[model samples]
Target: MVQGVDSVRQLFFGRDDAENDLTDGLLSSAVFRPNYAYREVLSGRKSLIIGRKGSGKSAICRRLAAPDGHPGACVLITPDDAAGDEIRRFELQGVTADTAKSLIWRYVLAVHAARHLALHVRAAHGRRSSRAVGALRAFLRANGESDDARLYDRLRRGARGLQSANLSLKAFGIEAALGVNGASEGARASRQLEVLEDGVADAFASLGCAKTHPPLLYLVDQLEQVWTVDADSHALVTGLLLAAKHITGRYGRAVRTALFIRADIYDTLNFSDVDKFHSDEIRITWSHDGLRDVALARARASLGAELTAEQLWGRVFPPSVRGEPTAEYLFGRALPRPRDAIQFLNACRSVADERGGPVITEEDVLAATERFSRWKLQDLAKEYLVNHPFLRALFAMFENSGYFVTREVIETRFEVRRQALHENFPAYTDSLTPEGVIHVLYEAGFLGVWRGGDVVYAGGIQAPPGPGEDEFHVHPCFRPALNSLGTERMTVQQGALLRSDVDGACERLRRLLDRAPLPAPTHTETLGEVLSIETEALRRKTQGRPPTSAQLRNVATHFQTLADTLRQSGHVSHPVTRRLLDEARSLTRTAGGAIGSGQGSNSEG
Candidate 1:
């Protein structure tokens, strides 16, 4: 039987690589791993979830937040996901970094607490949770609830309507949130903050009176995004940590806050009381076995009852020419991150689709390397763009160069060109020196140093520094993406590396995945459409073109799904709910009409 994109997607078993376990509904999703890390965070023993990107940090937070038979409410605070809640708007113009961050964090905590407290009224029915919060309503008064669109929806605005008391509380929130004030005003707000915290603590303390009180789980994610601006980024993350630690300490019985942060960022961050924070930290790690399990789980999910986990993976990944399971040939190409494994597998599937083969062949696996490498290269750029603003120039330094280079050649290769720039310039790295540039590249996973015959990918301690460390090879995975020494976009396809090869490889990936029409999306605005539009957009983005017709179709499809989900969720308290589905389906119709070639269909998007 012939296999292609449709078969590959069918094998996905409803798994969208683009989605997080949270919105993917982790509670019911088969990717659930009831491992130690899950238990530790769920039990409130570890508040910090640290991992490299795509290592399942978000999954852990979403899992810990599962409300299925879980004792308490879960208020997930992904600050970036919430529109209108900019970190900048919360900052004060004239305050110490610590004070400004603390005040913003405090206000954020209070608003979320108020929102969750009211929403969790059902759990608090036999107890005085509502009364405890209501009694302190005066203290909880804040003005900014209206600005936060999410506050109205998630905050449970039903129990008490637009009464003066609720209005007063909102006003109080606004007052508390306006932390940009004179020193004296700041002091006054601090006093009000103390009272609010005391009230929340007291309310949580009284929650034990309930039949089976669930601990309030606050899953805070996307802390990396908080680094959007570094001016006081460190202070901002610190304040969040301190705020969670302080508040959760008082109400440990009823409150558990888990913060998901990037491992690389966390490793380099400096803050006050850092050790204490480190003590309770849990790292999200991935091993060969664990990642295999993840792949098997996904395969199991896709194949469902037709094949068990082992059977599905066995069929998909047979023995390769190397006399090893094709799984190793595929998975070994990646670092131990889910993103790496998933992308590698996707690339293999794409090649198999391109070949019209039901199963991935050895040649298909080998050909997929160039594209997979390109993805990792872009992944590096996107993830590190903020932290290392000048990383591109560093990457360009590798263009056209062959696999091996000495430290002197690397420094000489880029230094004369690099050192001319002002030290303060964003593109200039003073550390472009021999040792420094080597370490930076190693850490970025773009290059690896060699000791005798073994390659060292790590930049820290394990890095080969002594005698034979002077020479290294450009990490083979990165070779396909780098350009020729001076030209741009001219990728090396003639068994030689070029600067432009990486630029063009990902476009090929798009074609590989975009084969065949998608199945009919359940919700007009389903994740399927989003993935479709986004996938098509990837090629255009690389070519520096605008969104293509396929992308618009996807956008419309996604909007429809979202509208349907909102309607079916049955809790459309927002005014938009009245006509949300109609507007969404309208978009679906409009978007569906844009695509040509009979491409737009309920089952084809």
Candidate 2:
């Protein structure tokens, strides 16, 4: 029955285009919205590309990795790339967090410098080639890599034995065999590392790398994986920034390094020589038009159809029927991110499919509200969990259906709940100041004005300096779900208050909340699920899909609705039974789809 629809569905959805995942590889024909990042990063002139999660960090990284994505062929080092995991493994090893950051960066620069030499020597292909190759070979051998292995494999593994490289190698092998400790050992290690860097530089000269494919462009991404405000995490991050600053000092022009990073992480870290990292840094900003343009590109790719996002959307969901797209309408429930718009559409598509529908209707989008909320909550958990483990529960107080509220409400709520929340989630233990919470929420787009415009905050909800609304609007994206929970609780309160028993109402509300206790997430055994959730408290974090209780209730409600439809049509006996039996068979046969195998990036870095 659904055979022909499969092709159209495939076209309609296009590629996965997930914000958190990566594409298979660089594609010359991949749809990319031409922007300054392409030019700057390709030129090897920009060292840092900063943006929010859905802002195309990975997209740009993918482009640079493509053969033609940049003027010079690029070497990609993504956060998930296993070959490059060693650089980050420093912290996992005995390296203290405080010192790991710097060491990691230094190691990264040296390793890449060595890689450039390897690429150049191999490219040259002659006697000078062997000499040039030998220099890099010394580096690899010194670093513990097996020299006999194939060249391509070693390119990514780096020289594993770097730690003991210069440690007076057995001028006392006897002392080493005896496990004798040397007080001067640390200095020897440092000197050897420095010496290795010089060797890589010399190899660069020997390869005549300047004549090789322009300077090699080295792209570094996802530093936040190891980043933190702690001294050790900070040191590692600072070392990376220092590498960007002193690029010419070691590799000179043989290699150009670019890092795609989260701006918030960068700003929060305490690093030295900031100007060097900042000098060539470019922040990816989007205009309404800009976002629309990118959205169209993705939509086109997904649909495999010829029209822009606006044209396609208009054809499918015309403004005459749906009204013009307002920021609050298109992005009302989203974070004004292009990726969010795409995902929202995907969520709508998922709902519409069950209706045997071809065109996406307004009802479809609206019906996706709960699922969309879960998606955003999943995102919030993934992005902020490492920093704030109790994110969702901490914000439960503000879930009051106040779309607009005075600042006093926020302050009072925090004042009442701060101590209790702090005790549970230590991320904010030292930061319970109401103002801090306010700033954090605002900066992260959790709270904002009712609408975007100039106005006054007659109440204590002070408007930002120059232009903006005074009213606070729980962001349409996430507030609704939280508010929905509150509304359900309100029903319980209303019944208790009907008897003029105010105390009874208060007691009822307390009991209701006790039952809810912040919607603890159950355990997720899958790694993909783990990757999407970042908090230390994984079992309590939001899941990819909304809570199952809501889903089961929804299913029961749907069955009742179907029975009503069957009665209205007078077809309950045969058609209804047949449909119900088929569904039951399908679920039982498929094992509820959980047993299914299969399958499964991005503006956001």
Candidate 3:
């Protein structure tokens, strides 16, 4: 239950990504969580695993692709940027975009299957390669697919062959290459592809691969690396779906395909056959208990100890942070995903280690919260950068503001920056509107809406914020980074009304400095900064919530003292001095009005 800094340092949560985690990090097949998605894919009951980034889609894909992980052979196909570009730019003159892309995907899967069968017949069946398998080997060599090449290279070759009718069909008993003289381009391509697929299917049937060996499991993951917000991207993904569905049917029980796609990208796809995929879709969701199990599993794997949740949470990490159970404080702040939980838990461990602790303390966890919050905030922006490039700009509206806000308050903020936002991202102007931005924020998990009694984020089956719905809370994951921890709503009382007067007074002072330059440049600069700092501090203190009446009187006294000092020092013009004094008196009167109206204690932030 207790360990030195060395032991704490040795305790690691796996890497953020599954690829690295499996190779050199703490993750291993032993600790893999065989969740519903993994089970469904292995059982061939579901082929689509949809979830947001960090929801463990890649973890399942990587695990399934490992040796001894899948019952049969496994092939993982992850397209790089180049392959994505090839898929996006691919077009056929005689076919719809969807059909055209589907053909390419089918071609890729067929090639991989052919290659697998060419070797499997001898290795698994323990017999001389059958004629069908030989034909597959010949087809592979004839098409330059015999050698190991990058996915992009293979896609490029396949696309060229399909588009120009250059594929070698002689392996299928034809004497020459496929010619494009008989049918339209799409028809010709489809027919040629069908011939190749049939050749592969023949090999599978001849060896009785389906009945003899486990079905070949094909995994397609990380499509988001090449995903974009365009029609071509949509077609690319749609084609993948169509191709995966076709593989299951075309090869009968010989081949199974699973596509791990981001939820945002998957939700954008629309096609007539979409309904048919309903049963095949399995969304990756993580519960708090699920995440805790994962953490404990990984902890045991890393530390070589079967630490219980009680020991891990109580001895390793603090039992409580900020008066809440440490587990709740940690998991409740993170997006309900494995990666987020891993990163947060690792951060706490790292902080404790850095402080030379035998075990993590409440201070360590609190310090880690700030660092984790900043990471999640920036990561949220990067996660949506491809689809929503203007996301980072929107964070400024929330910085230093309250975590809880109403639609009206957000709209007021948005209206101030509407024109500039449109100009900055003119291409996305349609989505830069107040409603559009709200939806984007909500969908990205930066903001959660209060529904019923609890706040619900975007990953659930809930609809987006409705027109009639208004209350929103920033996800706790991003609160510390934005310095927006206050959650109480400010009442519409005199303290709230004085908030604007205080802000206006500060703005007036800034404008006066802009208009009047003090005679002594250096001294003026020093004093001006001091005055500005004070004003800014007050403004931030009451930024998104009401200022207390006592706080306003303090501000009024500070402003009057500052104005009088500047006048005595002869660093300000008489006009500026008079304006400052007037503003100070105005704040004083506002503070008196707030207290006299019995509104001083009504508003709290």
> Which candidate leads in lDDT?
3
**Model 1 vs truth, CA RMSD:** 26.3
> Candidate 2, residues 395-482: lDDT per residue as tens digits?
6766656444435556667788877887776666665566666555665667664333322221122343222222344566775567
- Which wins on lDDT, candidate 2 or candidate 3? 3
TM-score, cand. 3 vs. native? 0.80
Q: Provide TM-scores for the models.
A: 0.66, 0.66, 0.80
Off by over 4 Å in 2: 1-8, 11-28, 79-100, 122-132, 146-187, 227-229, 320-322, 326-328, 449-471, 484-605
Alpha-carbon runs more than 4 Å astray in model 1:
1-9, 13-29, 69-71, 81-86, 89-95, 125-131, 137-148, 151-183, 209-212, 306-314, 321-324, 399-404, 420-427, 450-453, 459-473, 482-605
Give the clash total for candidate 1. Answer: 40
For candidate 3, the lDDT comes to 0.83
In terms of TM-score, which candidate is strongest? 3
lDDT of 2: 0.52
lDDT of 1 by residue, 1-605 (tens): 11332345455522333244445543354667665667787776788888777777766666655656235677777655232134433444345665656665765676677656655655565544456766454443443342345532422331121211223333234432323233454454555566556667666655552235656777778777556545466676777787788777666666678888887777766766788886779877666787777776765555453344444455565556357676665665676667687777777777887777777667777778778878887778777677666566677667766565656567677666665433645444556566666766777766776664466665224544554456566665676677422332222232122112222332332342244212334333333444554455465445433332233344445444444454456534433332333433443354345322121223322
Q: Worst lDDT window (10 residues) for model 1?
A: 158-167
lDDT of 3 by residue, 507-579 (tens): 7776766676455663475356546645665654444434555566666666666666666676455656667
| Order of quality (TM-score) | 3, 1, 2
Report every candidate's CA lDDT.
0.57, 0.52, 0.83
